[model samples]
Target: MVTIRLARFGTKKRPYYHVVVTDSENPRDGRFLEQVGTYDPAKPIESARIDLSRVDHWVGVGAQTSTRVRHVLNDYRRATQAIA
Candidate 1:
């Protein structure tokens, strides 16, 4: 089944990840359907940069985001909306 998840990349001690849409059976760093965004944990401050518009687009097209990805989206939405 197809799903959206993070794909590990980079070399040696430093690591990077790509937010990709791929098959569940594929390796974490293997082939994917599309690259939607990226995540960098090596920065002075940890951060995740996601294409929210693309994410919404994919979800609208019936692409299922992983639990982690959903959390990111949910957090962003909540923060932007400033719900009490």
Candidate 2:
């Protein structure tokens, strides 16, 4: 099954995440099909960036999103809309 989730990267104490699409059986930071967004906890919430068009396309193709990814997507959407 294909799934949408975060892939951890960055320094030991400084964490960064790439929202990616991959197989359900794959390891957390293993190979991913595509990167759709990014999350940097140290940055301001509004600074987080996401590619909603790609995300929507993936969802339409039956990709399932993790709970945390869903929350991040929601916040990103709201933030982008507010600035537009």
| Alpha-carbon lDDT, every model | 0.76, 0.92
- Tell me the spans in candidate 1 whose CA falls farther than 4 Å from its real position: 44-47, 75-84
TM-score of each: 0.69, 0.95
Predicted model with the maximum TM-score: 2
Error of 2 at 31 (Å): 0.9
Clashing pairs in 2: none
Specify the highest-lDDT model's number: 2
On residues 9-70, what C-alpha lDDT tens digit does candidate 1 reach at each position? 89988888788988889998899988987777665212466777887787788888899777
lDDT of each residue in 8-83, candidate 2, tens digit only? 9999999999999999999999999999989998997688878899999999999999999999898888888898
| Model 2, residue 5: C-alpha shift (Å) | 0.4
**Ten contiguous residues minimizing lDDT sum, candidate 1:** 40-49
